[model samples]
Target: MRLLEAFRGTAIQLPNRIAMAPMTRGRADDTTGVPHPMTAEYYAQRASAGLIVSEGVWIDQAGKSGPGIPGLVTAQHAEAWRQVTEAVHEKGGRIFAQLWHAGRVAHPGVTGRTPVAPSAVRQAGRIFSAEGWTDTVEPRALGEEEVGEVVRDFAGAARRAVEAGFDGVELHGANGYLIQQFLAGNTNRREDRYGGSVAARLAFPLEVVAAVVEQVGAAKVALRISPGNPENDIVEDDGKEVYSRLLAELRRYELAYLHVIDTPDTEALSYLRPLWPGTLVANLRSEEPTSREEGELLIGSGLADVVAFGRLFIANPDLPTRFALDAPLARADHDVYYGARLDGYTDFPAFDPDPAKFACSARS
Candidate 1:
């Protein structure tokens, strides 16, 4: 069968091709990782997407981002996530918990301790903390034993996600997090076995994948990666060869899908697609949205099986309906993209928010 056909047959079923990107809204209850009542209502509102990838959720204490960001290690976290998954599922939507470890991106004020990473180099950026946004400190480098502990943390988190009733788990390997920290050369200046060459650098992520797949079946596991993304100071020197080998390694597991974010041209996608050997979800930068006309072009031409939208999904809860009917889309408020609250998060009006506004396409 074709790649798109295979995606439709396996894993989560999508009512349409549109899938919501894993977006962070920071609405969890304090320290418990419980979704706020508003947060539950927010996701329930956006149930129109074929699949919803929940925000990046920390797997350990030291991996947390701020006061409201959730973690998946404890029973409290599981119970909280259960509410979220059940709410989305009730609305006929499938969800995946994006497993995350912030690594050096975390601040001591947030974790009440220094963050852990492959090396001691502090990320050259500020991180959100309870007090406020603060510069990241030099994180303590993980000893060889600590690496194994981190791996176990991820596996345990995967088990907790299953307990929480999520359809699957997507490893947070993108956006300069712990996994990306190891993948980058500048942040990882260690002489350890997990550092130095691209193959060695990928060891930590590969091990985490293996551990998670052992806990959850390979068909229920997906990984997200961003090549040449410097948003968080993630430099990818010779990223092509590095990602080529990484994709080859992923082929062994038969992952449910491989999601790549914001890569413009097809050069990297073309190079890595054959190596992946599974469903490909490409999230391109779309400013002027049109059924993801450009995105559909890529899909029809066979560059990707699905297209994930970030801001578009944020603004338009009923995006698939809007696309099919060519309805007007609500513009997203960038101010509320991060931090807490439901002003711009859940209160965004959809086509049928009120009975008067429900314009059936057949009405025309």
Candidate 2:
């Protein structure tokens, strides 16, 4: 196909089309959500991807992550992120901070404050805190004025991302976070302008996108949306109306890409792709181990411009190399996925055979 031909040729050059999906490595310092030196090296090691979407980074303190999840809110966070982005850039990599706000998913114990959402809905799950796992508390419903403040927070974060040297920013409008919670009918039962009809329900998210686009440029902003896979209590009955209209509006902004998680029926991608004007990234696990042929086929057939590989990128530092050579993939360790230490985070070995390389790679 011309896609493969374009990618393989020198004249039709773009870097590698495979992208590293943002995976939260809870290795940031607990008191402050600043990334460490090791974090820079970790991302720099995997600079081969055409793009790297850094893990879900909190836009404001209210949506701050529990324990070790890094944030991009403060000057300190921006400085630390500068180091990370500079390191990746030195390695000839492109990166975008994935702006996140984990509304109902956040706990007061972690934020040291009240959780806010579209409504005072309690997520039916436990969130990992510094003390330990705790049941999610009911979030306070945001007032109208306060909702506008949150949108400003998103714009502020996007500006911070640019200052921190990111090539772009991806709004984490997926995975049942603040925006998704509001978008889904089951979670958001408000009678205000932010809820009710599907169009009204999507107001906040759409506004945030428009704000960020104004702060950054249209080509520098991307949106990630999961239409139907209810991961963190996001339920949408009229998924077609909500997502189809959402995509239609998104086309107006001329976004860099739309990253959509694959659903069981593949309804989201199937319905939205024909209408989307920008690049589309389809994220899903169609098989146990993703083959180069599979990724090639997707891009080759015009299904996606890029395929985001999650766990496989975690275990294999040289994922692009492995894909190019069609090597056996490594399995990621689920045990140490989160924490302040680098044990399972930055310790994953690279393709280098040198003992010192392995030694330097390992962390306690």
Candidate 3:
């Protein structure tokens, strides 16, 4: 099966093309922003995945997005993540730390400071905090000098991730985060060298990538992007032009991989497939549940080198095994997905080899 074939990435080789996509579960320690012990167990339980991209890890206190999210800023945070990485590694799984900066999506109620973005604009949404849901505040426009500091922060975070025992780092440029805030035209209204046109807007994101590559080398870094996504109130009039320039510039870096979230029906996959010269990880979005069949088709057609499964991996820790056996997947519990306990985190059982026969035989 093409989906089960080995994939040689930039800095790591995977046993298969199935990757556990990064999903925010909000189960970290609220005060320290360290991942909970259960977090380590949770990831280790799913270590059979070819690659495990961790949840969005804040680079600094100022860039924190919400409560219960992990960070990579302090020695304590790194130490905590070391256990998680070690657990995965012991199981022969490769993991990547997804470096993130929330930008305007961060609520002052959560971070105790005003968020910063490319422009002083407030996205139309509410952010969850300890107090409850609070409206997103208008972010301060980052000064050109501050932009350099942000780039350094990302690079520093990448270094910290490696120290934390991660194989590499994935820059979270997708889903209208800080990098996407700079990429999307609606959120970025600055007239400086960092905004206005496509190339200008691409400046900060590309600079961030370059700084990260320089710090940790290109082979150890990956980038995630979602063009024309309306999430976080982002609107781009010309996604094709923006991504075209972005991808063309990115080709020179020869980074690890380009992770794009698009459905089979979207024009993004078609337009971006040829632009990127490196390995491509495609997260297919669909109204229905993602299936092994679809993943095989995506790999067989040469559209993606790796397929990432988010919700499925949540409910089925041994998802690849279940796919091999053609077993039914367990449904995820939405209510317990972000809870602090083990109900939905690590309590999901692996598939039984013979449910009916086992039950009858036990009774007999």
Candidate 4:
């Protein structure tokens, strides 16, 4: 099947076209923001994926979204992540760090820093924090100068990611995070150069891309965008104009790839696929476990160069093998989706076909 075929993308060559989607598994050190040692084994187990995007890693302390999320701000954090990258590399896998900043989505109770957005608007729902789930608050609006600092922070984080042994860095500009908060029409209500017209709203994300590319070369940089996604209470009225211009301008960088998230509400592929010429990583996002059929269709039809699977990767560490053999997939436990415990993390086993092979171990 095309899904299991080799990928010839310039960003990273692969034995197969199956890519592991970046999922926020709360298994890192909450205090130090370092990746847990088991993080290495967790990623290494799924090295068969064509490309693995590390979980959403915060760019700085102030940009932290919740407890247990990894960071790429300091030398210590880089050292810890180096182990993760090395482990993946040992298994012949290529991995990229997803540089993230939660922006208004960050709760002060979680990171001890006030959430900053393009505007002083409040999110209407509850968010995770130290005290558990709590009501979201009105975020502090970043001044023009402070916005420049955020851009610098992204560039700095990208440098740290390469030092951490990553093949590249994927800027988290999707899912209503910091970059999207600046790009989206509703959240960015400022009249400054950063937010006003189409160019203004696209300015922050474009600037972030440029800064990261400058830190690391364009080949070492990629971007993710979800134009029509409304997660985190985001509403985009002129998504077509915003994304059309954003993708058009992004052409200058000749980025490694463009990861796009598609949902029932958004026709991201129908509109975005034609705009991007580089490697296209398409994610058919859903809460349900991923099946080979979903990815096969995307790859067979040439809509996406690679398909990223999230929930399926949780239970099937040998997802590519199982896909090749048509093995029965395992169900993931939603309860343990986020936590430091390894119960629902690394405990998932590969698909074993020979029943007699484990007969003695099962009795023991």
Q: TM-score for model 3? A: 0.95
Clashing pairs in 1: none
- lDDT for residue 57 in candidate 4, whole number 0-100: 96
lDDT of 2 at 184: 89
lDDT of 1 at 155: 91
Error of 2 at 178 (Å): 0.9
Over 13-102, each residue of candidate 3 has an lDDT whose tens digit, in order, gives 889999999888888888889898878889998999999999999997888888789999999999999999999999999899999999
| Candidate with better lDDT, 3 vs 4 | 4
TM-score list, all predictions: 0.91, 0.91, 0.95, 0.96
Please write out the lDDT profile of model 4 over residues 255-275, one tens digit for every residue.
889999998678789888898
Model 3 weakest 10-residue run by lDDT: 355-364
Measured by lDDT, the strongest candidate is 4
Where does candidate 3 clash, by residue pair? Answer: none
TM value for model 2: 0.91
Worst 10 residues of 4 by lDDT: 355-364
Best by TM-score: 4
The lDDT per prediction is 0.79, 0.81, 0.88, 0.89
State the lDDT of candidate 1 residue by residue for 1-364, as single tens digits: 1212324735545666667888888877756777777766777778877677889898888888677887887787788788888888899888888999988888889878888989998778787788887787988999999999999999999989988989899999888889989888987888888999888898999999999999988887899988777756778887888888888888787777888875554356767777766778777743554345665676787777877877887788877776765676777767887776667878786765443454643254
lDDT tens per residue, model 2, 1-364: 2222323321112376777888888888777888876999989988887789999899887897578888888999999999999999999988989999998889888989889999998888788877898888889999999999999999999999999999889999888898888888988989989998888998999999999999988888988988886888777788878989998888787777888877555457677778785678778644465556667777776767777877888888788876664455667767766677677766777676456754564431
Q: Model 1, stretches more than 4 Å misplaced?
A: 1-12, 265-267, 286-291, 353-364
Better of 2 and 4 by TM-score: 4
